[model samples]
Every structure is written in structure tokens, then in C-alpha cells.
Target: MGRTSDAGEKILAAGRSLFEARGYSALGVAEICKAAGVPKGSFYYFYASKEALALAVVDEHWADQRREWTRILSGVGKDGGDAGGAQPLDRLRKLFEETEAGQHAVQQGCGTVLGCLFGNLSLEMSNQTEAVRARLQEIFDAQVEMVAAVIGEARERGDVTVNDSREAARSVVAQLEGQVMFAKLYNNTGRLSPLWGNCLALLGARAA
Candidate 1:
């Protein structure tokens, strides 16, 4: 990448890290600029305001998470074949296990829990700005849709006993977000394990 592009990316990376480690309202543009190793003036060149930079970070984070969710739920698209033949429940389990492991890795590397970016941003920005809140809601709605897709598959295949796929999907989202909140609170990835059974039971899915 060119120098200009590199500078923008640096600011974004630093912003994501800092904002994730600290709440959005708790950090400042000068701090982000310092973290990115860019001049404060250069920060303005890339982002018109700190809120703009925060939203950009949100977009980047969502892109990465959306890709992972698609892979986990739908499998990679290739010649009309799934990457794995695991059923919906199995896929859900894989998502849980992988999320735990990924968060653990983040904790080790960054010394922070770095839980759900959407959850973090929503709690901090929900009443702060309609634009950011709406974007966050859009991102979260996509996640709900992805989870709903899995539950729908489970229903069609008779893999689960849930009657309301939408409600069940919301329960799954709430449970996972709560788990992430606790994990972030305690800085322990293992906090996610006990809920594995709770989620499976909530969905009425077969055991892993």
C-alpha cells in the first residue's frame, strides 16, 4: 500500500484496539493519534472527526466478522458443496468453540478481552448518536439473520425442537452476548464454556 493508505490503516488499527480496550466515550482523538504513531494533523487528514474514525473502525470490524459468520453458518461456497457436512447444531457448536478460542488469542496478544465489537459499541453509543447506533443495529441485525438461518436449517432438518425460530435465534444472540460481556468483565475465556449446554438446550439441538 502507498504511504497515504498505510497511514489511514494505522489510524484504524489503533482506533479499533484502543476503542475495544476502552469504551468509545473514554478515548480521545489525540490519544488515538498517539497510539497510531501519526501526527494529530495527519489524523484529521484521514478522518474528519473522531466519530468518523470510530464508524470506519466499526465498518472494518464488521467486514471481518461477517466473513467469519458466513463461513461458520453457510460454509464456503464452492461448486455447490459445503466445506463440512456438520449439521446446524454442530456448526453452532463450532462457532462457540471458535469464538472462545479467538477471544482467548486476542486476550493473550492484546491484554484485553475484546469481546463482541457490536455489543461494546452499542452499550457505549446507543444513546450517543443515531447514526452510529443505527449502523450498529444494522450490523447486529445481520448477525441475528445469520443465527436465524442456522435455526431454520435445524428446523427443516429436524435437528432441533424449537417452534419459533426467530425467538430462539434472539435467545441465542442474547446468551452469546451475555457470555461475551462476562468474559470481558472477568477477562476469562473459560467463562464461555458452561453456556454451551445452555445454548444447545435453548435451541433444543442435539448434543455435540
Candidate 2:
């Protein structure tokens, strides 16, 4: 990476943290610039506007999360297959466990950016910034699709008995997102544990 690339990454890193910790609407370009230790002028050199930078931050955050999920999914098997073929439902539960563990490790509730960012921006920019809303929706849709894939795989492997894997996946994703929102709102990270258990039970029953 060149100097320009390095600078861009620094800006993105700062933006990601701020966006995750606060939100897109709460944090300003100047705040991000200051956090990055870069001049305001340099912000425009890398991004057209705050919205543009936000899109980049969202993309970067999504990429990192996808990798994390992939790791957990891949870690469940001796051969390193999707959760090691450990009953797709159980694998999914373990995935949530890992997610919760990550949040606990940071001593922060819900380390994921998607749910919080979307919830915040949807309320603030849905009517104004079509671009931002569209990008957020795209990321969310992809996440739901990934969940659906896992559920579909579980059904195929007889680990789940879903009549509609896609719908089931979407439900799981929705439940997880809602739990995260609730956890953040109340600052009670423990609230997610029961949700996780319930989801696992649903998956198990469906599989049976």
C-alpha cells in the first residue's frame, strides 16, 4: 500500500470506530478527520463527502464481520467445514455464542455495526439519503442471505427440518438483530443469551 492508501485506511479506521461507537449522523467529517489525525482537506482527497466515507466504513466493517463469521462457521468441524458439520442448528448457536463472547471480551454489548448503524441511520436518513439507505439495505440483505444459506445447509444435512430455509434464515437474522437492538438500548448484554438459546431451540425443533 502506498502513502495515499495508508492515509485512506487510517481515515476509514477512525470512521469505523466512531460510526460503531456513536453513529453516522452523530459523528461529523471534522470529527473523523480529527480522529484520524489528518487535515480536513485530506478527507475529501479520499472521499467525496461524509456520506461517501460512511459507505466505505460500512463496507469495511461488513467485510471484517463476514470474515469473523466465516471463521466461526469454519471452526466447528475437524475437517474445518462449516461448523464442522456439528448439526447446523448447533453451529448456528455456537456462532451466536462466539458473537456474544466477542461482545463480552470488549465489555461492550453488541460489537456488530450493522444492526446499530442501520437502526440509527434508518431513523435519521431514510427519507433524505437514499444512497445511504440503499447501501445499508444491501448489506443487510446479504447478511440475511448468508443466514439463509446456513439454514439451507442444515436442512440438507438433516440437522434442521425447515420447510423454507430462506424464511427461517431471515427470521433468525431478524431475531438476532432485534436482540442486539434491545441489548444496546438497555445496556444489558445478558439479554442476548436467552434469545440465543431460544433460536437454537427453534432450529433444533425444526431439525427434529
Candidate 3:
């Protein structure tokens, strides 16, 4: 049973990498099975179809992202906190800095999974795959809500000029997605550097 589970995980990991490197239309079940070293028969045993596997991949990816965001946010004022003595906005900056470092570490700016999956599917599957699109939308909505919470805190403390947390949150979330899209188009993460300050300014924080 453990070996079977491991095999399934291997297939999911391979699928994720392929989907990240090359958008959905470019990756097929056969290629994923080949990369995972799993037989076609075994692939069917795990996932009913390529679309099913894609859904699983999306679920896993968003789950992992939520956990990562939780960890970063939770660490702000807890024991062994990151960047002691930093304000909430500074901590948020650290979060982006860490993300940028990870992107550079992988030698691919902006970590293409979120951008590739959402961008490709939004364009290609809008009419065909409503379920997939809805799932992706839910993940994005959750992220936007998280951003709103952060901005709401800033507003409470008079750190930002935004009158509506919800609107500010949406704007910041849109900017983030736009930045990722621009990074993907340009094949460079540096396009996001200037926008970081712009985000701070939007939050009424002085540029650091």
C-alpha cells in the first residue's frame, strides 16, 4: 500500500513539473507516466484520465501554497520569528523577498506553476473545463481574501490610505497576478522589482 501511494505521488510530482515547465496542452498522460517511470496501466490505476490528474495536481498545488502562506504569516510574531523588530509591512516584504530568492534559486523567475496553470487554463479551458476553472478561481479567491486581511490590518493601524480593505485586497491581488503574467511573458522576474514598491505605496507605506 505504501509503495502504491509512493508511485501515485511520483506521478503527481512528474505531472506538476511538466505542467509547470510546459503548459497543460503540451503535457499528456503518456509523457507524465514516462517521466514517472510508471506504466500506462499503472497510470490508469491511479488517475481516471489526464483531466483527473490535472485536477489532483491543482488541488495539491493550492494546498501546498496555502500551507506555505500560513507558515510565513504565522511566523511574523511567533517565537523564532523572521526579521525580528520588523513591522508587519516589513514582514510582508520579507515574504516577497523570500519568494524572489526561491525563484532565482530555481533559475526560473516567478515559479511558473501558478502562472502556467491558471493562465493556460483560463485561456484554453474557459468553455470546456468549468470545474477546473472554478477550482482555480476558488484558490485565487482565497489568496485574495488573505491579502485583504493583511491590508485590513494595515488600515486598522493607519498604515495605509485604502478606505476599503476588500477593494485594496482585490487590487493588490490583481497586481500580483499581473506581475506574474508579465514575468512569464518577459522570461524575467526583474519586471516585478519595481512593482514591489508600488504595492507598498498602494498600502500607504513609504518605500523602503
Put the candidates in lDDT order, highest first: 1, 2, 3
Q: What would the per-residue lDDT of candidate 3 be over residues 33-109, giving only the tens digit for each residue?
A: 99998886789888988888888988887787777766665445334556462455655665566555545555454
Return whichever of 2 and 3 wins on TM-score.
3
Predicted structure 1: lDDT: 0.85
Clashes of each: 0, 5, 0
> Residue by residue across 1-208, what tens digits does model 1's lDDT show?
3553577889999999888888798999999989888888899888999989989989998999888877877654334467574677777776787789889999999887889888988998999998899999898888888898889999999888899988898899899999999999999998999767988799887553
Error of 2 at 182 (Å): 1.4
Global lDDT of each model? 0.85, 0.72, 0.70
Residue 206 CA error for candidate 3 (Å)? 5.8
Residue 180 CA error for candidate 1 (Å)? 0.8
The prediction achieving the highest lDDT against the true structure is 1
Q: What would the per-residue lDDT of candidate 2 be over residues 9-107, giving only the tens digit for each residue?
A: 889889987887777778888889899888988899999999898888777777877777766555544345555435556667677887666555555
Best TM-score among the predictions, by candidate number: 1
Instruction: Please report the TM-score between candidate 2 and the true structure.
Output: 0.82
